[model samples]
Target: MRPLADRLAALLGPLAVVAAVSFVSSLGIGVMLPLMPLYAISLGASPVQLGLMTSAFSLMNTGGQLLAGVYMDRYGSLPFIRVGTALYAAGNALIATARDAVSLIAYRGFAGLGAGGNLIGSRVYIAQVAPPERMAMVNGVLASAASAGQVIGPAFGGTVVELFDLRAPFVIVAVTSGLAFFGLLTLPVPKRPAAATQRIGAPTSALNRSVVTLLVANLFLTSGFGGFITTYAPFATELRAWTMLEVGLIFSLIGAGSVVLGTPLGHLADRTGRRRVGVVSTIPVAFFGLAMVLDWPRPVLYVITFIAGGGLTAFTASWFALLNEASPEGRKGRTFGFVSALSNLGTVAGAMGASAVWQLFGLPFGLVLPSLSALLAGLTLLALAPGRP
Candidate 1:
């Protein structure tokens, strides 16, 4: 136990730095991300245009992840982390100057590149440093850090807007991202080890049975998430007549649940069974959307959203723990990049498609998309993927 304690302590040293970086970075991004729709709307963006903006951002994010993945093993993740965060900060600065929806789309896409770079780099770094035994917990901690920032961001964004203007939050995003960039620059990353197993050359593909199954599940899951997020603020604001502050708080509820429950759920997955926990996780999150069909009171809505957030965190911890374990030695970067690219494509589809759906059919239909996607995700997980305890 003493030896185990010492090992975890050693692991936490690096993880702690990353958590801090993620938290600071996510705080700014979170404040801005959900506001994009409202921003576009304020710029007279139609629903179709709004969908395009989201798709473009996600598509660029996919491209950046693929690009970073190809070189991460050779160069290590530290450079990507610093560079990506820098680009992201620059992109947010650009966002503050957008005069039209078209410009917003272009600027957002550029920012997506930074987001991709930061995400893939962070995951690869975590994979390298965390032991298989602790992957879930480590991931949970990192996610919680990010989520913690998000929990504060939405409400803060609303407050910032009330205090200043809509443009104010993007400036905050740029500033915070800069802080994260400088923070990550200070980490003492070790040199990259030689890619021993990668002598096989960068395969044209990273697909295999386990990987394919897992990626498919992830695609379905993220598709649901993309669909839900794309329509979230508009639905709450337009249909329910909620204020930006209320909407932000609702969004924060999701993040708050993740911050509070992420580590414990990951620990649960580690203890019970990854597959079981992952499948069960879909329940609350999926239902949270469905519950919106009712005209529930505010408190009820908050509770539901919070539980959904916990389920979302649980799914993330369990599924990614499996993914981290499945990555091949010397190829973690490429595999993660590959998975992220494809899964994010699902996000693109969800965002674009759901936008059109809500525009044509009405908002209630939008809620159904995520629930369906969650069902598909659970089915895929149940059918394939490793069920290691």
Candidate 2:
């Protein structure tokens, strides 16, 4: 057999293509995400409308993944990826023309469909291509690349908004995503590789119990994360009196932390149990959430947010690896899709829940909501002992 180096070398071309696609697509999304609240606010969106806008995106993303997962299992990822990129580009472009809160919310939801397709397809492609021993590390690298995009995109979007206009970021996102869609055309079509024989239907028993446990764990954790992220920009603006540039920098720090830590954590997860790492990471995540509730100086806010970002990033990398390891062989696509759908469902619930609470009480309670939920997930996962089976 060829040496492992040679084998990996052969896979490099395809890996590069996938990574590029992931980076560019995520770049487009990152550009929009931090600025989304500002854009909606410009359109006169209330906190409730803001919550609904984010919820709409998550809802559509969840639905899209459910559909894409099935089609990917039946057919392949390349076509879905291409179509998804096109739609993503279109959605971003259309959002630039949105003149009202309702139109912006609708456009964002439409964009989520494309985003979901791209996310699921890229991950499934990675699962299919990487060897089991290296899967987590590869996934981590992909996550890191996505993080890198987040780092750059937000800063760029912030600068654009500060320099030019609120609408400029949407236009830039559209142009870049269009370029990324063209980039997709140059890549060779990917085929789903064969794996261990899989039973067709789900009886709950069809999958490893650990897999189910991990899924449940993700549901709660993702909800908390979603709530935190959705509230992040808005709270910074209204409560802390931050500029758009400052908000972008805070988000950039989060992405920067993730990019710095993702690969090493992935490597560690591959060696130790992913569940163990994920469980440990959530502790700091919850603590930071609580910490953020405290009124701090702007610089202190950056430091705390940075550390919280690292914890959350570590948790997600390990969690994703665990999901990959726990999935049955032949159904990687659908299995991941299920997780994606569930995770987004949690996101919608968390964001809406937090927004409601924020509307009622204040920023502190809104901030506490997600962190407390994460604590609950961590405790539950510990009780479940996810590594046992």
Candidate 3:
């Protein structure tokens, strides 16, 4: 058994630094998410326009991941991380000064580039440093940090918006992103080993039919969830007559569930089977998403949302563990980037389509989009499980 002191040191080392960077960067994103739709509305954005604006981020983010993936394997992730965090800060600063919905869309798309870089780079870095036996735990730690950031950022950002103005949150996002950039700069960079500098396009057996199947599953899953998020604030506000602060509180519940359950669930994934945990968790993830669309009491809604958040954390831990294990060793950057890009594609499809459905069929009908997507994803997993596991 490892000493307690050794465990503590491992927890607080470079791995922790990467997790901290993810937390700070994700905090900026969380700060803006619950408030952005309202801000667009203030700029006279209609439902379709709001959907477009929300999707602009995902579209641009996909492009960024594709580009970063090609290069990061050739170079390394540190430069991308620094640049990505800076882009987030700069984009938010621009967003603070936006005069109309068009500008908001443009700036947010630019910020998406930064978000993509940060996510792909961070994942690649973790792949390099994490001990294989504890990959799920490391992912859980990183996810928990991100979730904690989401919790604090939205709750605080909502209060800031309510007390001050819609623009206040953007300024706060910029500040937090800037802090993340500087924090990333503090990490040491040693010369890359020969094996670490392999060509980005090198062929590997890991990127086979099974991985492709999983990516397809990822696309469906993220799309449903992404669509749900796009419609979330507006639905909650319109159906429940919720205030901005109330909406933020509900949004924070997702993060709270993740923070509370992430580690334990990851440990569960490691012990049982990642695929089994992911498959079992999908039902609750879908159910809770559908539940939030209903007109439950506010407190009841909070409990449901929290459980949904836990479901998401468990599902993510399991799926990511599978992906990490399957990825080719030297080509982790490209693999992670590829998966992120596919996931963002689903986000774009879901967000844009959900709003359109909401506009045409009503909010409750639109809420069904993600739940349907989750069910499809679950079905895909079930079919593959017998073959793979």
Q: Judging by lDDT against the true structure, name the best candidate.
A: 1
lDDT of each: 0.81, 0.75, 0.77
In the range 289-354, model 1's lDDT, one tens digit per residue, is: 777767777678788889878878888777787776666666778888889888877876888778
lDDT string, candidate 2, 1-389, tens digits: 36656756766776776777678777877787778999899999999999899888878878778888878877777777777777877888888899999999999888888888888887877776665565666777778888888778776888998999989888888787788778778766655544434435322331567667777777788789778876776777887787988766767777877788777877777778666767776776676666556765667667766766666666776766667666766576788887778766677688889999988998778888988888766665564454521
| lDDT measured at residue 128 in model 2 versus the true structure, 0 to 100 | 69
What lDDT tens digits, residue by residue, belong to model 3 across residues 1-389?
Answer: 46644744654576777788788777877777778998999998889889788778978888888878878888898888888889988999999999998999999999998888888887777666555455666787888899998888777887898899999888977887788778888776623436566547433665765567678778888889778877877777888687978876766778888899887887777777777777776786677656766665667767777877776777777677777766666666788788778776787688778888988998887888888887677556664435222
Model 2, CA-based lDDT: 0.75
Predictions: Cα RMSD each: 4.0, 4.1, 4.4
Q: Once model 3 is optimally superposed onto the true structure by TM-score, how far is the C-alpha of residue 29 displaced, in angstroms? A: 2.1
Error of 1 at 120 (Å): 0.3
TM-score of each: 0.84, 0.81, 0.81
Off by over 4 Å in 3: 1-8, 37-52, 98-104, 162-165, 189-203, 230-249, 289-304, 351-366, 382-389
Count backbone clashes in candidate 2.
0
